[model samples]
Every structure is written in C-alpha cells, then in structure tokens.
Target: MEFFGMNKRKIIAIADPYSTGHHLSYNKLLVEAARRNDFKVVYISDRIGCKYINEIFPDTDIFINEIGISNSKISREVKKIVFYIRAFQYCRRRDIACLHIAYIDRSIFSIALANSAIKIDKLLITLHWNYFSSPENNSLINRLETKIFSWLSRGSVNTNVHSGLIVDDLYIHNIKSKYTPYPIAVLPSITSHEENKLSCDGEIDALVTLIRKADVSLLCFGGMRYDKGADLAVHLLESLPEYTHLFIVGKPEYFSKEYLNNLAMSLGVESRMHVYDQYIADDDIQSIFNACSIVCLPYRESFSGQSGPLTIAASLGKPILASNNRFIAFEINNQSIGEVFDSLSFHEVNRAFIKALEKSYSPKEFIEKHDPERFIESIGEMYKVNND
Candidate 1:
C-alpha cells in the first residue's frame, strides 16, 4: 500500500462488473497511462472484469470477487445493498489516493464512497448514460431513483458527467457534477485467438456469410432498444435499394425478430434483411466495421451521452449516419465526423441516407485530440485542479 515510508500516488479504477468490452478497453488504456505517469494503478472489479483485465494486462494488480449483483428484478435491491457494503470495505482496505469509476448509472456505490468517512484523497465517478435526460425513462421507479440519486449527487464532488446536456439537466435538478466527455481509446488489434477464428464455427459463420453476400451493408450495431431506433432502421433498410442489406446485430430487447420480420414482410423487403440476434465478438469488431458501408446510429432524441459506437466508428474511420441527438449533434458540429438526420421526420431521414452515401469525413483530427494518453492526462490535470 506504500512505497517506502510515503504513500504513492495510487489510483484505482473501480471497473464495473456488468459492462461491455469497450469499458475493459478503456480501463486498459487508462491504467496503462496511469502507470506511465508514475502512478500505481489498481483495478477493483467482479470476476468477469478481473478475468478480462488479467487476459489483457497479465501482470496488473487486480482485486476481484463476486459482486453477487444481477439485473433480475427479483433480488436486485438486496444484491446491490450487499455489494455496496463489500465495495466500501474493500476500498477501506486499500490506500487509494484516487478512486476512479466509470459508467455510473443506478449504482449508489460511488456516491456512498465519495461521502464515506474513508480518507480517500479523491473519488472520481464517470457517468456514461444520464437517465434524467432521457424522456422515455419516466417510469415511477426510474423517476424516484433519479430523484434520490440527484439529491445525493449535489453534495458530492466526485461525479464526472459525460455530456454537456446531462450536466445542464443535473444542474436544473440541483445535482452539481463536472462535465467530462469520454476519451477515445485505441482500437484493439486482431489477437492470436481472434485470428484463429476457432469460434467462427456456428453463428459467426452465418453472420459472415450473410454479410459477404450483401453488395452494400448498413450496420445497426448495439443492442436493440426503442431508444436505439431499431424500428426506424428496419424501415429505412426496407426503403433502400434492393442491393442494400441491413445487418441488425446485437441481442434484441425492445426490438424483436417477430416484429422486424412482420415489418419486413409487410414492406416486402424480408429477402434483403438479415438479423442476427446475438452479441458480436470483440475480435470481429473491425470485420463488422469493414463489412458495412455505413454505420447507422439513429438513436432517439432522449439519448444524452458520448456514444461508444460513434467513437468506435470515428476511431475506425467509418462513415456514420446518426440521428441528431444532443451529444451526436454536438460531435457532428464540432468534428464534422458524421451526417445527422432529423429524427422527427421520415423524409429527412431518407435524405440523410442519400447524403451519407455521397459524404465522407475524416476522424483523424478528432481521434488525435482525444487519444488515450492525452485524455488521461486531461483527467490528471482536472484531478489536480479539484484537489488544489
């Protein structure tokens, strides 16, 4: 816990257990940067996150255990309470100068830690998605949780918000938090395991086959949700030329095959539509990006955060056609990295589609400005400013 008699500038990234490969990639970039900056980097995460960190960074110090948390409604509350207690005790055991957590949502652990009696020099919590900004997230339970969280967040100096829009929303609700956009991490290379293609046997084969057969592909990646514009994507794909195919990947939640098939059948474009309702492999990320002519992100207006898919698309230099959501619109204006559609109008969407085909933008400048090292350094500067 201490180097010699003095406590080192120890930083621990409290990586969330239930997160995407994107988070793992971000963590690897972060800690590596921290290590280069002469800080002892520690990672505290659940079993899955720990295994991934080990595989990625073999010699990193990681504290891993079962958080016993589930998304299931039956025992979510009980599990979260238990996890919070354990997380508190775990942090108390370590001599952490700064505790950095990313992608905070409904979790109360960050707020609790920041306000706890533990003598942490600083606790930084990065919020990925902002629930209060999403119009559709107005259920009684969600509202109640937001109200409670926002109330507690006002008194905490640890929270880092990713969107200017979310920051404004939080301010209106009296929850003061810092606005810090997510940094663009480096794209992962094709690993030996990935290059082997041993796991390409079943579903992936079918996916690759479908993608290969298409003359032009429009990728609607990420999980299917109402906010993600799955229905709109299906409809747009239906309206496209016969040679164009829509590759709808990722597990379906609010969107379903039955609904999409029925829509496709009705639109008489079922033959041109190929849907793989499963999670895509991390190694095949470049393949997916390459296979598609355009990456579509027609998310609803309610989305108010830095989009990982958008960042990845930019990182890979893929052309993007995204709806004019708050953050996406801001990025489009700031970087000219993508074309935006008027999400309110179908006619405008069709025009945007045509525009994307003829348009291109370089992500080179954007990518350079937010590279991992540059980004982590900015965070270090901010931490210094806050501590000072």
Candidate 2:
C-alpha cells in the first residue's frame, strides 16, 4: 500500500485582509493549492471584522478568518490584546493546527497571545523584515524582536525569507530561521482585476491609449514623493528629451495637487508628465503597467521591506528600472530579474531610464525562474498535514 499516504493539514492564515493586496492573494493561493493535493484548508483574515475573533469557517476541514488588528491607540491595544486572547480561545474551539500570521505587527502580538495555544513542535514565524538593517530603527524594537525569536525557537517558526542576502544578515545578527536564508517562496503580487479595468473608457482609457501610442521613454511609478523617487523621476525625465511621460500614481504628494504641478513647473516637464494622485484600484493597476514603456522605483536605502509594487511590475514582464540598493539590486542579481540602477545619483537614474526604454525582458521567464509552485505547494501542505 502507500507508505506516505495523504495527510491532513490545518492552516490558519492571518493577515490584514483589508485590501486585495499581496497578503490576501497569498492566502487565496495557499488554500487553492491545498485543495489540489486533497488537503483541507482554511483562510483567516481581519480585513473584514471587529470580532475579537471572527471566523470564515471554510468549507474544507479547516477554519480561517480575515483578521483585522489594532495597535493604533492605547485602548485599542488593550482591546486588541483581549481580542487576541479571545482568538486563542476561538482557535481552540475549532482546533487550529498551525497559524501563519502575515504582517509583522499581527505576527508579533498574535504570537504573544497564542503562547499557550502553540505547541513548540508546530509553531513558526516567517521573517519578512531585517530589523537590523533599518537605518533609524530604535534598538528597543530590535531587542524585543530578538527576544521574541529566542522564545519562538523552541517551536522554531520557519523564517521564510525571499533572498539569500536577508538570510545571511539574519544569521550574522544571530537571528534564527527555518528555511533557506532566502525566503522559501516568491509569489508576485497579482492585480485582482487589473486587466479588466485597464480597458475601460473615460480617463483611464485616454491616459493609457495616449501613453502607449506615444511610448514614453521614462515613467516613474510609486507615489510622487521624495522617498519614492518623485523628485528623481522628475529630474531624470527633464534630463532626457527622449524620456516622455512619467506616470505618477499612488498616494498624492505632501499636498493635494499643486505640489506636483509645481514640481512639474520646476522641472519644466509639466506638460509631458501626467500625474494621477489617487489610489490605483487593484483591478485597475494593469493600466499603470500597460501605459508605461518602463516602470521605475527609485527607493532610497532603508530597512523598510521588499517592494511589492516593483515586484509586481517585474512579474508582468515589463522592463523595470529600479533602485540599486541591497534588497532591490540583490533581487535583480539573484533572480536575473530587472534593470537595476543606482538610485542615489540622478545621473545614474537618467542613464537607467534611457536603457529601459530600449529594452524588453521575459516576464514569463522571470516567473518561470522564480517558480512559485514549490512555494505554493509547501504552504498548501503546511495546512493539510497539520492535525486539528
């Protein structure tokens, strides 16, 4: 008969499911993948409820909730702690085998609350940040994180990292993880309906058609802010006449409107640049990709985290000219990914912009190389093999 027969895994995916962003999409993929292998799955998110614990109670042999968390106010923290404690009680009610918390804030506190609920043999925490690498980070946060990891080691939550660079740094810092120094998986962000909305009429259509036809040489995305390379985007666009339009999307700049208008006037590319100071809906994001000849993210060096937005552009197979910092640059080098450029100097950004306009890369090949199936399969099994 079968030596290793099918196993049952119960996974509780906890994240800020408020938007159709990376975290939520990852959960969906996990559950679906589990189903393919005859494994029971449950997705839990807080994006929908105020329930100290609300549960989706999946149709499978598992349970999940899209959990929302609160760390904003004093009362909110107290209420959240109490709510999380109640969540442990709820997990007990349904027999949650392994809980995977997505965001840092959610994971840290959730682990604290689920202390008694977790069995050392089954506990895991995925490391999504390099607390040591942060520029102005307070020592207190790092200290506490270190202490938390030490505590988590008994159960030893696997720190699934996406890069070998992070793995080495964590080890150098004496932090612990369970998988390869690199993250175990790389699930590129997907636009829920990014394609459908791109084809819609009105403002979105006009902008897309105009930009695509004109085929602008340089386009900078992310918010039009200094940190996100707003000024650099403008500076580079002005430096190169071939670089036509810079599609400035995401949250508005410091002001409502005039900052961008003024920035354009200052750069003298006001007429060439088009700014949409609004949140690009998940379904409508493809327009951002389709409208630009190349996507650029000139992020300043910091220990913030991975660039989900930049990664999104890369996955779609567009030519992405990105900051040449450690995380972004390493991603390009290790994965054979995109066009990595020096973000510190405007001259470098200008040169990279020009190069991107003339280049095209295999988006499909990038995905093939990253190969999300292993990542997806393991997560799926994580839920299926655990006994509730």
Candidate that scores best on lDDT: 1
Task: Please estimate how well model 2 matches the true structure, expressed as its whole-model Cα lDDT.
Answer: 0.56
Model 1 global lDDT (CA atoms, 0 to 1)? 0.67
Q: What Cα-based lDDT does every candidate model obtain?
A: 0.67, 0.56
Q: Tens digits of per-residue lDDT for model 2 on 1-388?
A: 1112333133453433334334544555555665566544443445332132223324543223333445465655565555455545554445554555444443465466566554433444555666543433448866676567556644446555555666666566565546543333334334232365234547666766667876464556554454566665666576555547776766665434577668889867887776767656545566657667777676666534566666667677677777766777777666655677764465766677667766766666555544567667666555444434
TM-score of each: 0.84, 0.76
Clashes of each: 0, 26
lDDT of 1 by residue, 221-334 (tens): 888878788777777765466788888888788899788888889888888787888876676666666667888887887666677677767766677888777778887767
Candidate 1 TM-score versus the reference: 0.84
Q: Candidate 1 — which residues are off by over 4 angstroms? A: 1-13, 19-21, 68-71, 109-121, 133-147, 154-156, 186-206, 343-346, 382-388
